[model samples]
Target: MIQQYGSGEPVRLFTAGLHGDEWETTSRLLEQLSPPRTGTLLLMPKVSDNEYLSTLDRDYYTTYAPHLLRAIKTYRPTIYLELHSYSKESYAALTGDGRFERYGVPAYIDIEAGILMGSVSPRIRKDFFTPNDLCVSFEMPKGPNEQSLSVICSLLDVVKECWSRQGFVAYMSRHYPQQTAVAVKNYLRFYGHLY
Candidate 1:
């Protein structure tokens, strides 16, 4: 289901629970969110009922939950934040010594917050939303824990602050230069344009 709060431009959409098993923590996080000070916040706490939609495959969402896809298209959010979780065992694969390093997963460790932040790759974003829209995905270690919840909350605050002042892409490009460059290059290489 979707719950909307606040109003105006730069509509931000937050979706969790695309995979049934990983829904709990993200759903709880979305449930506790307060109304934004400016612009609209569209929260979809549960996006799918299929446990098998376990991967970040856009096709699964399009096929299984067409209504959710329809909702996203209709809303046309300026920022789409998709929340998900990974098992503790899988966390190693995503970090320093793992797939992130070898495969360039477009993820970074937020030194100040002590959490890993993952942004949608340009290739994936091309399939899901316009280049101008910022699409991010945060994958917490599975289960409910204080640190994970706090990190997400802090990230939310950062997202809001950046959106209000300098815009998400600008702020991200300033701080996360490498990831931003990779995203831009990938977008340009594959799509032949940034906008």
Candidate 2:
């Protein structure tokens, strides 16, 4: 299902659960959905909600692509972040830094068009749609943990910068800053530090 929130120029689309059992993105999006978001946010938590456990192939998910495609055409979003999970090796290859510490720290956000290889939703088939839009396919470990917060936080950092460039920002005035600060404080406290 498609759910929308916020209002402004340069609509943003956030999609998750394209691959079966990959639920981190969906969870995070649902967690942060209630407060009035900044800019246009379109969320499709589960593209193939029915086949979530029975398949991982792109074709299976593509069967339901027309629905999202129609939304894209209608919303004309200028940004997209398709979230998914992948293997640790997949993460290493993307970074090429040989770091296997599955903390979901640094996410891959510079996925170029057409070259479908590593993690995340791989390539969302938005054919000829939002060509100039800022697109990213983010990935996490198959067995996600609390580290997923780091990934989400990092994504927020990037999105803030990118959105600012396009005159689009999320939750700037709605205690979003305080929420982020609290998250940081909580993280520090969890790690046994005071901030």
Candidate 3:
């Protein structure tokens, strides 16, 4: 079973580590935990931690996806975001389309990159989402390129604010503080749209 938090009008579901090796994403999510009863953000961490021990390089798609599928079917959340880490690339959000959707929400590869470039700082040049749109996985910077603590906090704040106001029925990248803006850029790039 998975864990959850918050429970009000707008439900923000944040998850980490479908793939256990993706420690950066896991660390980040773990660090941001608030009390569950706040009824706002629902967090599910290490969804695949035990399964990954034997599976190795495999992500959550095989072992843990069924649980997620069931939850989405049951709860019907406003948005569902699965987080992961890639050491090589920058960051991305996964959409469900296959680079062919008209609305471009599902399987829309590099949608995050597109959104961030239009609304974020120039320092972040590259990022991509899986095209699923439901999830946002990211690649931490290599060497000295890591974002600052202030920047991370800012990004989280923007995500909370934007999701709260607009809801997830539609796609929109709202305003964020300058420091937090980079995480938005990174999230868009990392979550490119997967199933």
Candidate 4:
């Protein structure tokens, strides 16, 4: 269900559970739902609730792509964060250049040229990102462990702070010291090894 919270400008939209088994990510996104200190927060625990409830994996577009579009259009969020997880093969696709160790990080924020949606068109990507706006996804590793929960919590907290404050790069670096140097420029993307 989509729960609307908070008030004012800079509306924030967070979605999780496009995939049926993504309980951890869905729960984490729900936990972050609070009346924002300085803006609005729109939380969608499962965009495709039927798929999630059935516990049967299906493509997101087949079920409820309209719900996702409505959430974006209604909120017009200044920051849009989609929560997802990565399998071994999918993880390798991004870090295959050998710069990042395999499964080294708990979560990541993919902004550029990464597939965040299950089966949406390219036009939908524009909903999550716009110039001078924050658009990113929190990627968890396959079968999230205990550390995964902590990572999701911390990242969401940091994202909340960044929404209200300026120069959050230093704050983020202090919390996740293993951050890459390029994180400052592309602060929207946060991960343990890759930026």
Full-model lDDT, candidate 3: 0.40
By TM-score rank, best first, the candidates go 1, 4, 2, 3
- In terms of lDDT, the poorest run of 10 residues in model 3 is 117-126
Q: How many angstroms is residue 66 displaced in model 1 relative to the true structure, after the best TM-score fit?
A: 1.8
Give the top-scoring candidate (TM-score).
1
Q: Report, for every candidate in turn, its global Cα lDDT versus the true structure.
A: 0.66, 0.50, 0.40, 0.54
Worst 10 residues of 4 by lDDT: 113-122
Scored by lDDT, the top model is 1
How many angstroms is residue 130 displaced in model 2 relative to the true structure, after the best TM-score fit?
4.5
Give the per-residue lDDT of model 2 (tens digit) for 37-154: 4577778776654545322245543465667667667787777666666666665455543322443222232232211112223234234343345554555556556656455545
Candidate 4, residues 1-195: lDDT per residue as tens digits? 778777777777777775566655465556655566776777877665344432112334434466776767767777777676667676655434332243322133332233222211224443344545665555566666676656666666666645632334456456544443343333333221322
The C-alpha RMSD of each candidate to the native structure, in angstroms, is: 4.0, 12.0, 9.7, 7.8
Residue-level lDDT of model 3, residues 1-195, one tens digit each, is: 555655674555555565456644445554575544434666566555553431111333334455644555556555445444444333333232342233222232232222221111111111222132233332222221334333433444444443432332132333334423444444454333322
Candidates 1 and 3 compared: the better one by TM-score is 1
Give the distance in Å from residue 168's predicted Cα in candidate 1 to where it truly belongs. 3.2
TM-score of 4: 0.64
Q: How accurate is candidate 2 locally (lDDT)?
A: 0.50
Better structure of 2 and 4 per lDDT: 4
lDDT of 2 at 61: 38
RMSD of 4: 7.8
For candidate 2, list the clashing residue pairs, or say none.
none
